[model samples]
Every structure is written in C-alpha cells, then in structure tokens.
Target: MNTIDEALGAVVAAGDLAGAVGLVWRGGAAQVAAVGWRDMEAGLPMHRDSLFRIASMSKPIVSAAAMTMLQERRFALEDPISRVAPEFLAMRVLRDPDGPLDDTTPADRQITFEDLLTHRAGLTQAGFHSGPIDAAHREALGPDLDSPLSPDAWISGLASLPLVGQPGASFTYGRSTDLLGLLLARMEGATLEEVLRHRVFEPLGMSDTGFSVPPDKRHRRAGLYGFDMTGKLKKIDAPPGGVALPERPGDMEFASGGAGLWSTADDYLAFARMFVDPSVKLLSPETLALMTTNRLTDPQRLGAEMFGMPTFGTGSGFGLGVSVVLDPATAQVMRGKGGVGTVGWPGAYGGWWQADPTNGSVAILLMHNMLELEQLTAGYGLGGYGAIMEFHALATA
Candidate 1:
C-alpha cells in the first residue's frame, strides 16, 4: 500500500467509516476533502461545513471561554468557586468507595475557578437520585448540564458526589468545565451558550456551534457515528434529551461544558487560529501563560498514578484544560510538528487539534466517525494523524 495514499485512502475505505471529512489548514490557507457518504441511507455527501460531533475537542474551546472570563475579571482563576456557586463552600469527599449516602466532610480547599477549568475540581456526575444533593439538583436543575440550574443547586449537586480523586491531584477528565459553564451562567448573568456565543464564537466567527443542531441546518449537521470494538459503524443520531424539536436546540439538554456541543471544521479552526496569534487572545497573555504551564507539578510520579501511562509530551504535561509540551525528548512520536510550546485538546466523539507557537500554526482534524487510527501509524498510538503529519513534514522539507 502506498503509505501516504493508504493513510488517506484508509480513512475513506474503512468499512466502519460510513462518512469521513478531513481538513488541513496551515499558513493561512485551508483545504477540505471528504470521502464516502455522510449518510449512506440518505445519500448525503460530506461537505466542508459538515457539522461533527467534535466531542472532547469541545473542551479546549469551552476552557478558553472560561479563561476569557478571567481576562475580563469576571472571576479569578484561584477564586473559590463558592463565591458564585455557594453549594460548594461545604463540599465533601467520599470516604468509602461504597458507603453511607450522607457521610461527608468539608472540602480541605474550596474548589477554585482554576480547579474547574483544569478538571482538578473533584466533581462527578454521580448520585443523581440517592442523596439530598442529587435530589436538589434534579429538582432544581432538571438533571441537565445544558439547562439552567441555580448556582447553589449546581454546586451542591457536585459537592454531594464523590470526587474521582482529591481535587488538583490527577487528570480525571470529567465534568469540571461543565461546572465552569454553570458558574459562567451564574456570574455573567448569561447561559453557557450565550457566554460562548457573545465572547468566543462571535469573535472567532464560529456561526454553527451550539448545544444542538437546528432543523434547517440539519443538512449541515454531520451524522453522528460510533464504531464498536469490532469496527462496525452505527449511526448515533438520537438527540440527548427526550425532547424532540424541529430545529437543533442549543438549550435542549444540560449544557455539558465537559462534552456537550457541536461544531464544524471552519468554525473550530478559527478558534484554533487565536491560539496561534494571542494578540487576539480572549484571555490575558499572563493568564494564558499560567494556564499553559504544566500543572503536572509531580511529573512522572503523579502522572503514572493518574493515567494508565504517563502521557507526557516533549517535556510536556497536563495544564488547566489542555496538554502543554515541555520537552521534545519526552515526545513519543519523534517526527511530528509541535516542538516545545504547543498546547491543545481532542474531543472524544472524533477530532484532534493542536496549536504550536513553535510552528506558528494550528492543525485541526475534524471527523465524527471512529476507526483504529493507529493503523496508519507505524504501530504508534498517534493514530492516523501521525502518518499525515510526517507526510506533510516531508513534503514541506
């Protein structure tokens, strides 16, 4: 198989990938290409603006929005979250993995705004019905991350649940940013969608991102797809909530700051561009610097315990909401772009993006279907992306 041809073709050929869209934008120009069909059943062709379930990729965007609030002094990173969401002032830790529902204590340190952005807050989507906290959230907030809940209700719900580990201890990707969105709603006197739209999306010119897809624009909404372990692709087109509407509703479900948004390549790349040029920074350079710094203060020891493997970059470590590169020697895939000062995040549903000041460019991959992308690698976990980056490097070289 032609290595480059195979990597590009495999994305289209993968039986599990019913539809695929790939975008490459660097040096101020972009080219979008698609293969197969967006909907085999409906016979829709994938387009440049095809909306995707850019899941975890949503993290960096949402995280950046929170940092913007900090820039405006809407709040400080370390400020106790309890200032706006009072329920967290008396938070507790789960003493036993499985114990009494109400058994709890006051949090040693108040959950700070930084903790929420960094996923360092010990918040869980746990106990939706068993405890008073869950009951309060359900009753007051409607068990939705996207909808409105009293700040007190949001904090109490999170505080009442067991933390994955002590706050700021490890990188357990959970609902930390979602809490930040809820906090933004309380503090900014606006909803998560509103905060994002007003502050980030409008500025970046991201027109199609929101809580849900609208009906007229459903044509643009890429069909959501998931593959089983055996690599069988199935369409996951169900709206998260029981409510069904004619248009995609950004306010339909709990505005999940952690993982609840849809976006397109063009829209997302514009936001990624800001990272490359911080002169348009939504957050102060100092705040961005503070955020980009590796919070992996313990480096190897702490990292190993949290993640199955220590996921360090070229001297890189985990930061508030993105990955920060520290040393090139520590990089696993020896031959890609990001040198030392790159930071980025990937969405779970399907997408990867990185911004490297070192490269003076941001590379974003947006696709909604899953595949064993590592097959394109030389048996490397960087997946299909590794091969693409290497090929581009050689082409430019």
Candidate 2:
C-alpha cells in the first residue's frame, strides 16, 4: 500500500504542482497530507490552513443556502422568480449575433426558484455561448464573473439579455447560482456574502472560506497561475473580490456564485462534511438530496476534445454546479469505482472535492497553481482519479 503522504509528496517534488493539500476523515480517524509551498516564489511551506480561490466550488454552497430557505417556506420551488426579481419577467431568446431581435418567443416557462436551485434557469454568462450574446454579455455584465458589479447591476445585466435556451429546458452551465445569490439577497435583505456567512459558513465552522484573500493572509495565499499547452505554470496577478464571512477580514466587490470563493483544504473538507450531516446549517436532507440529483433535463453530449479532458467520454450529464458521471465505462476515468451515483465538481483552477454518499466517503484535493492543460492529468484529471481510488481504499482498509 502506498502511504498517502508519499503520494502527495511525489506530486510536488516532481514540480508537477507548486503545492497540494489532501484530507480524508472517516470511522474515527483522520489523515491529511499537504506537500509543497503555498507561495513558490518565497519557498513558503504549504500548511493545512493555507487558503485557495476555489472557483465554482462556491455554487453548491450557495445552492445549500437557498435550499434552507426552501425548506423554511421562504419561497416555493415552483414559484416564478420574476416575483422576486421582476427583471426576469420579459425574457427573450437569442437567435444569433445579428439574427432577428424583434422576432422572439417567451421562455418555455417562467424561470422558477427550483430552476435556479437546480441550475435549470434560462440565464447565462459571457463566453458560454458565442455570438451577439457574447458581445452583449461582456458589454452588459462586464468581465468574467469577477467584475465589480453591484448585485443590482449584475442581475439587471443578466435580465436584460436573451436566454440561450428556455427555462428548465436543458443543461447549460452559467448563471443560475448567481441568480440564487441574488434571490437570497433580496429575500434576506443582505448581501450574498452576508447571507452565506449567516446561513452556511459560520454554522459549518468553516472559518476561512471567503471571496477575497486579505493583505495579512495574502502571504499564505497560493499563487494563481495560468498554464500553457505544455503544462507550464505562469503566475497571473491575483484577482480581487470581497471575502465571504471571513473569521479574518477581507473585502471584495464581486460575489459570483459561479466562481469565486477562497478556501483552505481544511475549510472545504468541513464544508463537504455538511453533506454527511447538516446539523447546524441551511439545507435539509431532502434539499441536499435535491442538490445531488441529476438536475439537467437536456444535457448536451460533449466530446473530450471540447474540454481537453481525456478521462470524460460521451455520456456525462451536468448536475447543479457539478459534473455527474453517468457511465464509467464510457467516461474513461482511470481509477476506482465511480458509478452513476457519484456526484462531484472541479474548479477551473485546480481545486476538486467529491463525496460519494453511496460509499460514505469524502475526498478533498487542493492545488495552488495552474500549469499546462495536461497538468489537469495531475491536478484535476489524475488527481480526481487518484483520490477516488485512494479514498475507496482508505475507507475499506
């Protein structure tokens, strides 16, 4: 059997990663292996407490918050969101960039609370679809979800655009969670950050998840890197946003439910723990059940070439915020038993976590820098495969 410590050590020592944090806890025992430096430039060591910008991992958290409100009767899943957000009332569909604008049709149905919760809503962000909407989204919503827009501005920008498809019609990954963030804000009369803190983070005792890295903790923060085709890490300037309920203070203007929460491997494991038991926080077992289900009504069949992912094949579906693997034989994953029941998501950067309730197992894999796309073979691609088998072996051992 390979010592987990050695497995993590080999990844960093080979320069395949700047740093990584891995944690597995179950059956009255716990193991954590964090190797490599948090900041490579200064040769700082990686700590269990080091923070990461867990892009997209933030969605399931926001969905959990909305689910709590759902169980509370704060809103009905079927209720049209236009009741809370009137901007969605006059929705339009895009034909093309220069296609007919005056000729349009209504959404298949009004966007509902459940649609937002399950990511079935007909809203989108820039770059998901190409054409006039792309130009329109950039002009309307500003830059990649990190743009400094007030919640009203963000909502209005999305509302003003045309739907790529109709509400609850299919699976398209974009802005439904941000809409949930907006819905929670309007319902609670608080900012998205405030709602998440009061509703999720503080209750879970995950003290370090936030939207921005502060000046003091900035040193402990991992470098954000962009990778080339060959998998080389190129550090990019750190992006900024308000911290979400930090035990420590930091500020950020953008609160993207799609992507933008900073977390430590430890903090995220605590967040994943909520799935095992939701004793203190926002979601009920039923709502959490709702979250993990295959929520997409019409998911497109994507080839591995589209995402540059070698492990995925032609038969996967999108669940709310995560990729739901439907067929392992077709999916081409390299390790362990992930069946249709396995539900998890990975970040665009290098953060990945998955919980298999079927197995009562959880795994957290964190990386600080981005290298070439092939690096995902190590970062998300290979890391996910390794973690699945490693976790299964750990639990069974």
Please list the Cα RMSD from the true structure of every candidate, rounded to 1 decimal place.
5.4, 4.8
Tell me, by lDDT, which candidate is best: 2
> How much RMSD separates candidate 1 from the native structure?
5.4
Evaluate residue 221 in candidate 1 and report its C-alpha lDDT on the 0 to 100 scale: 70
User: Over the stretch 1-397, how does candidate 1's per-residue lDDT look in tens digits?
Assistant: 3343345456556554555455555677765656556776688877778887776677777788887777778888779988887766766665542445466555677778777776667654433224444444445445443445445555565655655446666555556877787778778777778888988899888999987777788777767555444445656544333212224444353477666678887888788777667556566778778777777565432463222344553366767678776665564332123667677776644466677777666666566544333332223223334434543443223
lDDT of 2: 0.65
What candidate 1 gets wrong by more than 4 Å, as runs, is 1-6, 96-105, 126-155, 228-230, 239-253, 278-281, 299-315, 332-337, 370-397
- In model 2, the runs with Cα more than 4 Å from the true position are 96-103, 228-231, 239-252, 278-282, 297-341, 369-397
- Each candidate structure's TM-score, on Cα atoms with residue i matched to residue i, is 0.80, 0.82
Model 1 residue 263 distance off true place after TM-score fit, in angstroms: 0.6
